[model samples]
Target: MSSNQRKSFFDLSASGQKKRLKAAQDVPLPGSGSQSSSSRREEDVPDSPVPLSQPHPSSEDQALGHCPRSDELELCPSASSSDEYEIEDENNVEDSSEESSNDDDHDDDIGIREKLRNWASQYKITATALTALLHILTSHICFSSLPLDGRTLCRTPRNINTVEVEPGHYSHIGLKSTLIKLMSGVSHTINTVILHISTDGLPLFKSMPGELWPILGSIKNVCSLSKIVFPIGIYFGKKKPIDCCLFLKEFVEESIDVINNGITIEGRKFQVLIQGIICDTPARSYILGTKSHTGYSSCIRCKQEGIYDKGRMTFPSVNAPPRCHEDFLIQRDLDFQVSESLLVKIPGLDLVKNLPLDYMHAVCLGVVKKLLLTWTSGPVNKCKFPSRLVNQLYSFVLCHNLSAYCSILGFPNTI
Candidate 1:
């Protein structure tokens, strides 16, 4: 770690909010964010230019010193969810420099060292609360520049080998016929996986569930976050806006390979998010009450026509409502270039279930956070997406091509 990073790490054991703020300055920002020596005035600190860490907004409004916002709470990966659980763990940092080599390296020195160790133990407790808050802020700002999840599909003669065509859902798994046809129409094999995670979801190794099996074995890479919510949401059907970004992070990580190896397919793309709880789906209606459903609303990550929800309505589709917003399409061409590599029939719940809870939680939360943040935050600097980005166009073999797609499949209002 760089000196700045080292300081930030050390700040993990800081005492007061002031010390925490000072420590935050050490996490230098890149490019234009860093301040130039010439621009530095007597009061202007070196790290001010980047605005890497903004003063706590709440604190700015308080008297005298900072806002004294909710006394910086504890944010360790291992803590109870209740307010009391956020209490700082009493452990301080040892100032190794203070350890004297004198006392002829005898028992006296040992006593002095123990004294320092004890003091440091208490220091850690002092720092924990501040550290947690700062980390919460750091995680959030760190992921502000995330990209969108691009779901694409490109098909042609090479990958398609389906001879006998049936109307109703293919009864059997039809592994060979379907896989080959899917493969034949496929132009590539790699996929770009973006995994979005919330603040709480980062340390997934310690939390993911052990009940599921891996569907993609070893192919995973290239993830990012649209927002920084803590603690990912992994359990089946759980959804929390605070944890929505986690899902996007995972997919982005795996997407790099998808882009490199997979052929093109359809091009519709959406982000994912992990709710703090088990989210059923994002589709709102009488289902998602009035509170904006945040990450719980159906996102492209979980966007699939259920038994009959289909077509373009306001919320759109038979399954979920029309999309609240669609800002995750920056890399449409990449989507057009890689969507075909995806298995349309893959089990969403089952596949995600295999991941550790923390991992899955992070992925789900990250995706949701990013999408909502970007959309609600409104209008960002972006280039017009390429038209080719829509290549994931799927072809349906309708009994009578009679308006295979109904303009308005369901009644207006909620459903």
Candidate 2:
């Protein structure tokens, strides 16, 4: 070691005074003569008392002064051996400290991962948001081992198979697996899932002929609000499916399996019941293999014969005999059902009873709105309201600020 390094290393010991005494005895006078030795003793001893104002040399300074110089190589051989031992001790301490630091870094990484996952779940954060956050973190912090992609962090599957129901047409996402995933967290002993199925044709654009028909479902009496609606099947076509039964074949088969055998979730089997199938008049007619809404025997609830009115078919009877499941099974009315529906294959499903009239079509957007429009804007007859009454109604609507209802009435500008 250098002279400065040796001084610093020996300074850690409390034996500085003993080492100085030993060094003075071992180191002989530079010249071989009595005169030289007498001169050295005189130089070591002060001529007069050190002035109090000048201060005294500290122990550290004394230790440095007595430290062996490079030219006196043969004088002190033990100091070199002592330095090697201290250096080895320092190297071992450094190794252990590095190991401990590595462990701390690993724990920190786990903590960061758990915190991010909890934050994402609590806020229902999107993948894009997580990806942005990860980019910022990786740019500023040194965590190259952590996943950079949001999908990987979110644990999203990469190899999901898309089932094609028809060529360039429909796709079926497995219903059984979806149900298991959705209901896996339920803690009930006897789980009962009441499912509601709905389907409708969706026009993609007004300028294009392309359209989509997705079969969606929801679980009734489910506590979780986030998973209300899920897709079971979807179809893209220039027009509606050629055959309704073929379109619904996959869905019907799945429904039958779920209702009869039940599905296992988290090692517990859940009994699924088909609560209802909801659809508008046109969609309902298409799925049930019945005539269109304009047909004379289009009403699915009852066997009420429709009469030809001023411009269209109208069902005026309020107390018509209700249609039964037996009538549907037997195909009692030839005019009503054009073909058998695929829904009949499901064991416990009722074609007529289990199919409820959709609220959006049967009430809010259909009967009530149409009746109001007919009374206000129809031909001048008993159905048309008086001019004074129509003005009062318009004023009432304006006073209430019922813009949403007026907009749905399709007369926002006129009103």
Candidate 3:
């Protein structure tokens, strides 16, 4: 149906009210001038049975023991109490025809709900946005069958416990369960499923020292800006997790089961693969139980020791000995390995190959942002461009409409 028609349905239902009209009776009142004439007219008119198809009065009307048609009873103030029982008897009988209209109204309600569902899914509306829309419509529109809660409409869980994962920590929803839910009814075969897991520490409050270290994972095939991102686990404390192995205990156990002996989602077994574990330098060091980025043995890819230059550790060697998975598993470098990583328990997962640096963290946000800030705001040097050259470059960007390009590169309106 058209949008206008859908809106009119609500408007008509809210504004239009069914008025109950009753037959006027010639009952005499306390201040009546034509008492004899009313009695004569009542005697002249013969009483007839009320039609079955006529709308019945509600229970409240029957309990009052009188008809409340004020417009018809303008001349006669008093109503006969004898008709009260008769009205009760009429109300007791079922009106099947009246219910047909209600059935049609219910059909219309279902249609409207279906349209709203399709519209929401087509436009990819967020749960919060759709919930707000449903609330607004429920409050203003006069719909008997309209849903008030967004979760009810979306068919999601109502109560999600934050303490369901473990005690003294935050929540952890399993990856295998989430994958089963997402890949329930697929047309094509999904023999292998790839995933990218990431963990990072975020400060919750600035006034206090509350931090959250969440283990987030996403499917490689469906990971996008528009898609829903679900977390594997979250740790909430004043600081980061004290023990990284203990924090990743549940994730490692669950991932091992799925990786070793595949998951059977809806009776279809599918193999799971860890595509990568994307993380920043500090977060990677924390999760992998290695020295921090400033340490001598902080290089994740190679076995080269960092040199302390200008009061900062730096990796100047380009031809360093590359580290392999076997070396990492065996802990060949004592300086590189602080403690054993729980991620090693997962079957068929490479500690080196499956832990790749993400472009956003390692390149765009890290190197490119630092380079731009240094060139634009840092002290003047040979690397910093002169004012005339910077203005020309800015003009060239405006001429080529490269604002979006600059924004994607992690710097907006800056050459």
TM-score of each: 0.15, 0.63, 0.63
Question: For residues 25-88, what per-residue lDDT tens digits would candidate 1 score against the true structure?
Answer: 4544345366753443222333222232344434233322333221242222222333333343
* Root-mean-square deviation of candidate 2: 13.3
Of 1 and 3, the candidate ahead on TM-score is 3
* Clashing residue pairs, backbone N/CA/C < 3 A, model 3: none
lDDT of 3 by residue, 1-415 (tens): 3444222211233223121111234444455565685574454322332232344555665544345343322242124534765676676654555687789888898888888887888899888888888888887656646787666786777765565223246667888888787777755555888887888989889898878888887776643421556788878887777777778888898998899888887888989988788888888888888899889998988889999999878899999988887876888888998988887777777777788866787788778888977776677875777888778877876677555455554334556
Candidate 1 accuracy as TM-score: 0.15
TM-score of 2: 0.63
Candidate 2, which segments miss by more than 4 Å at Cα? 1-134, 142-167, 187-190, 225-227, 318-320, 378-414
Clashing pairs counted in every model: 133, 0, 0
How many Å off is the CA of 146 in candidate 1? 46
* Cα RMSDs, all models: 37.4, 13.3, 20.1
lDDT of 2 at 397: 67
Report, for every candidate in turn, its global Cα lDDT versus the true structure.
0.30, 0.76, 0.71
Q: What's the lDDT of the predicted structure labeled candidate 2? A: 0.76
lDDT ranking of the models? 2, 3, 1
